[model samples]
Target: MITTVTLNAAIDKTYVLSDFQLGKVSRIGQIHAVAGGKGINAARVLHQLGIRTLATGFVGGSNGDFILKNLDQQQISHDFVKVDDESRICLNIMNASNGESTELLEKGPLITEQQLAEFRQKIVLLGQQSRIVIFSGSIPAGLSTSVYAELIEALRKTNAAVFLDTSGDGLIHGLKAAPFFMKPNEDEIAQLTGKRPENETELVQSLHQLADSGIECASVSLGASGSMTVYKGTIYRVRVPSIEALNPVGSGDAYVAGMAAGIYQELPIEDCLRLAAACGTANALSAHAGFVKREDVDAFLKQIEIVQL
Candidate 1:
């Protein structure tokens, strides 16, 4: 079974408008609210793929009740530590005409030491039975940057593989623990490596450098250009063919979910990237997070071009 941890979960609200103007009233075309957090999103996708998943994290207050109810409505199993403060809400405003998106995210509830300790205990117990433990998203305030590293270390002792998807300090800290795989976008790669890549060759080289530092597998997401994955001294680039993009939000999460699923299923690395790209492309067809369909992934997987780099 796959276990996903979302330390900072939220109620995600997405609004669609034909033309968004500042200092003016605009009617919203559509609005959506769902369980929001990287790990939860991955678990949702994984569940839809027919994988057994358990989501764990910290949540509290009436907002926490809403999250719990929503997960129950979706029939997703979860275990969360109750906290004092209310969980956050994230706002995504999508431009209907231009296919553009703007995100307004709120910092999540501050976790107390006692509550965090309980959360860790729950994860340690879950680790004993989980095959793949995915540590994703941000660490809320009051948690050390090395929190994920610490979690990975615990999961390692239990013989569960770790897949980390985070950025900046979280990425650096998690790398020290040497996760089985990591999915960082280009901007995150720049932040970690200091030197930025101007092209795909340079980016592959940088990915190699990161792998040299002890990371087992690394994939740098290049947005519309698709993504590049480096594993076992070989570099593979999966290019996303041009399509009428409806929404780009959650594509990276879909990619991570695909990669995690592939790793869990013991598929080839190239196949993993193909599934990753396919999931991402499927995500672009819908505005909701974790909205990719199995049929869409199957269809897109056939068209993805994977090149040796």
Candidate 2:
């Protein structure tokens, strides 16, 4: 089974409107809400892919309850530590006129020290039962940036392959644990290496730098241009067929889910990239975050091209 960690889980609310004006009232055309946060999103996609997945993280209050209920309704298994504070709500306002999206993110609840300890213990225990443990998204307030590093190190006793998808100091410190895989976008790569890559050559160089630091595989997502991945000193470039994207919010999480599914199945590295890219593209074609139709993935897979670079 694959285990996913979301330190700060949330209720994601998407509002669709014809136009959004600053300091003006706008009538909503539609509203969609779901259990979200990077790991939860990935878990949802994994479940859709027929993978056995368990989501672990911190949640509390009514929003937390809603999150858990939504997961159960979706038939996604989850075990989360209950906190005293309330989970956050993330709002996504989509403008129908020009397909622009505006996001308002909450900082989430503060976790107490006791709560943190409980989660650490729970994750390590779950890690033992998992073949792949994914640590994703942002850490809540009051947690140190080294949280992922500490948890990943604790999981070293288990046989689980760790996949990390996060940003900022979390990514920096998590690298010390040398996770099995990581997918960072261009800005995130720059955040870790302290240099923004200007072109494909520079991007590949950055990936090489990450591999030298002990990470086994690192993929840099290039949005519609597809992605570039480095695995065990070899580089591969992936390209995906373009389509009109309905919503690209959780595409990254979907990508992580596909890669995790591929690795868990012991597929070849090239095949893993193919699946990952397809899942990401499929998510973009859907209106919901972290959602993909199985048929879409299969069709996109045939169109995705991968070249060894």
Candidate 3:
């Protein structure tokens, strides 16, 4: 089973509009809400793909209860520690005018030291059930940036493979623990490496350097251009067939889930990357977060092109 950790969980509110206009009245076509976070999205995708997954993290207040109830209804198993402050909410505005999206996010609740300790205990207890641990999203306020790093160290004791996806100091500290893999978008990779890739070659080289930075594997997601994965000193670029794009959000999390699934199956890195591209592109053709269809993934997999860099 795969375990996912979402340090900052939120209630996701999505508004679909016919057209988003500046300083003008807008009509909402649809509204959807769900329990969401990067790790939660990954776990949801994995579960949809018939993979066993367990999600855990911090939650509190009415919003937290709502999140838990939603997860329970979805039948997605989760173990979250209760806290004092309420969890956060994220607004996803989908503009039909140009099919663009704008996101407004609230910083999550501040986790107390006692609450964090309880969370660590939960992790220790769950660590025995999962072969892989997925660490995603940002750390909440009042938590140390090294929180994931510390968790990585503890999970390492069980010989569980840990995959991380985050940015800034959280990523920096996590890297010190040397995870099994990481999937960072291009911008996050640039910020971490301090060298933006102007071209494909530069980008491939940058990914390789990340592997050298102690991570066993480093894959960079390039949105419509697909993604690139570096493994065993080799760089492979995977491309997805273009389609009528619906939304770009949650594509990265889908890709991570795909890759994690492939890794768990012991597939070749190239095939794993193909699965990742299929998952990401399938997500782009949907409206909801991590709402990619398995049929779409299967259809897109046939068109995925992979080339060695």
| Winning model by TM-score | 2
Candidate 1 lDDT over 1-309, as tens digits, reads 999998988888999999887789988889999997888888888888888999889887888889899999999999888888998888999988788888898889988888878888889899888888988888887888899988888777687888899888988888889898888888888877887899877898899988988877889988788999888878888898787878878788888888888888999888888988988888888788766899989999999999987
Instruction: Give the Å error, residue 199, model 1.
Output: 0.7
- Per-residue accuracy of model 3 over 1-309 as CA lDDT, tens digit each: 999999999888889998887699887889999888899888888988888898899988999999899889888999899888999998899997798999998989999999888888888778877888999998999999999999888887675789999988998788889999998888888877888888998998888788888888889999998888888888888888978898878899899999999898889888888888899888889887876789998999899999987
TM-score attained by model 1: 0.97
State the C-alpha lDDT per candidate.
0.86, 0.94, 0.88
Residue 281 displacement (Å), model 3: 1.0
Give TM per candidate.
0.97, 0.99, 0.97
lDDT of 1: 0.86
Best-to-worst TM-score order: 2, 3, 1
What lDDT score is found at residue 34 in candidate 1? Answer: 94
Clashing pairs in 3: none
**Candidate 2 accuracy as TM-score:** 0.99
Candidate 2 residue-wise lDDT at 85: 95
After superposition, which runs of candidate 1 have C-alpha atoms over 4 Å from their true positions? none
Model 2 worst lDDT window (10 residues): 94-103
